[model samples]
Target: MNSLKLPDIAAQKLLHVTPLDWVGMCAIALPIQLEGRHVAAMADAGVNLVDGKSRGIHMSRLYLALEQLEHQALTPLAIHQLLADFLASHEGLSTAAHLRLSFEHLLKRPALVSPLAGWKSYQVSVDARLENEMFHVELSVRVPYSSTCPCSAALARQLIQRQFEADFSGEVLNRESVLAWLGSSQGIVATPHSQRSQASVQLRLRNNLDTVPVTELIDAVEASLGTAVQTAVKRADEQAFALANGQNLMFCEDAARRIHQALRELDIATAFTLRVEHAESLHAHDAVASSQWQW
Candidate 1:
């Protein structure tokens, strides 16, 4: 038997040494454990090529390290450990490691006033970094809701009032007649415009937490907005949703403020940035507002 030597090209010295900030892979598909479920996720795994003399980082090591997320529930500690593994594998070749995972989180939501329920998916991403022995993690989520324009509602109410005055100009006003008129399409000539809206938030978590409060954060945002989009609905649920929209009229700015206050009260994150986007049915352009705290 003959012993053959294998070539190690990555270990070879470079003629012009230059350290790269980041090097590895992006959009690596994998299954990850989240909230007791196996979720399909994509990851961006990389490490800083701190060793200028080295040709490149061992990218295979970074890909193999992602296996830790397969069965274990995602948490701050798990992400921290994964980043540590990246650094440990690279040793002297890398000084810092980074990981980003993107996935849709499924939640079963009950109808507003029915026993029926359906699944809703929220766009979520987890970003983590390990540098100078410090570990940092950020959690982001996009929540879809419904927003009714306050100005439009007010305008609709004015039109309805004028129509009422015109309808009963000479006739005697009575509860039955008024009720019938209110139920007729002629009575309510205009209706407020409502559109689907989205709230995107990024939170920098405090280092002391063991678990990520993803559901709790989503709940807070939905509760604050008060008009989250429904999945499955009966007529009763639809009516209730309409009532919710009627009572919770808001502009993009108002939605942003509501979310900002709610997340601040949660106190789970040291800093956060949030943006609310209203896909306005009244205008051709979208309405958007952004807010941040200690970020």
Candidate 2:
């Protein structure tokens, strides 16, 4: 039996038709392949509704074109092709297309001093836009690390010295005594406050790359910060992490500069912006710093 004709509200023309800058679906749940594994992702697919005369854009067509991305590996070529498909599907209705996918990129990471390894999740975003036949791509990642305040370290050292003087008052300092005291809790009384921090980086990838350099970018940010938060850790690994934090003391400004310098050396990035947030334990408010280059 033929289905009864239904009213089509989407196709109904308005009395005053006006153009929309952007119109489409957002936060759509979809499974996408990244690298060789399947990862669940959310996509924001849309196009510029430039056809004012038309009642509205064919939203289902835009969605169908985006559905093709479900089976394809997420890459620069795939993203560019998907955007082209978006425009092609819109035909005369759209002059620009944009797609954004957000997902967690997981990688296996080895402990600093242990044989154990564990999976690490990185918040990743792949954004692409095609306007006037010009294509562009951007990659963003969030990395967590440890930040030790330099000022706190200095204050802690001062307190430790005073404690040591009180413990060994009017006594000649001896090597064995000092060593014993250093090994004991009394010898190392004060500790600098260190807190968890994160660096959020966005890079305008050069069009010459075959795929996103997610590992390289994460490595650079970790290297710059120097005390990346760990997954699996033995006692030795914990000690090593503590030592790293002590050696890599930094303020928020310092963290920002380090990340900025590291990203500047990478050739994959045509331009970049970075933000470092030190979730300060000493204060209720967090300390933050940001830097950008090449716009």
Candidate 3:
């Protein structure tokens, strides 16, 4: 019997073909270890086929190279190594390499004024590109919060004031009776409408950092917003949350500015872009605001 030879279409050079800007694969399903937990992650791996004479790249090499993610933490150094492997596998055919890994990061969050806690998930993405020996990494995270409209709150207070005056048109107001009425439903007729909102932040980080600062970024976002959505709550916790929301009432634009200033004051992120979305209860569409800072 004769030995069989496998066909290598990827190695065959085709003349006069235009080189592709990006080549390889996307949405490849894989399971990876993130900070010790096994997380299912989708990977998009690719390299630029810079050599016009090369017909194609070894796509399997890119796929196999992603296995490194499953074994190690997704850090800047790890990503750099992965990108290097991507180009090394393609050798003379590639000049630049890129990788995007997206996954949900889950954390246990305690409720306000409660002993209980539960898990909350945040959408996270890491985008890496190695071009011309300059490696760049960008991280994106989405955090859900509660946004209260300042205008609506003021309008509601006005309506409540008008009702109070009508109730005591000529009657002398007293601390005792006034407190009674205030405790009654007539004193609290309406409340400002609020809804769930999201803050989407993208940060461009400097190299030489060892680990991914995922938890730190999430903490910064929550602290800036001041009214992050709760996971588990008792009645007291719910009341505390309401009080926090009342104290930190903000519109979409307000949320964006808060995030921008908070991030700048921290001075951790090299460059950042923040966007806030308030899923308004008063409108059919969401209200959005964006801000960016770069040096």
Evaluation by TM-score, superior candidate among 2 and 3: 3
Residue-level lDDT of model 2, residues 112-214, one tens digit each, is: 9989888899999988999997988999999999999999999999988998989999999889999999889887888899998999999998877876788
lDDT of 3 by residue, 40-96 (tens): 778899999888988888999999999888888767888999999998888888999
Off by over 4 Å in 2: 1-9
Stretches of candidate 3 exceeding 4 Å from the true structure: none
Q: How far is candidate 3 from the true structure (C-alpha RMSD, Å)?
A: 1.5
Off by over 4 Å in 1: none
Each model's lDDT? 0.94, 0.89, 0.89
TM-score for each of the candidates: 0.97, 0.94, 0.95
Give the clashing residue pairs of candidate 3, or none. none
* Whole-model alpha-carbon lDDT for candidate 1: 0.94
Model 1 / residue 218 / CA error / Å: 0.9
Better of 1 and 2 by TM-score: 1
Winner by TM-score? 1
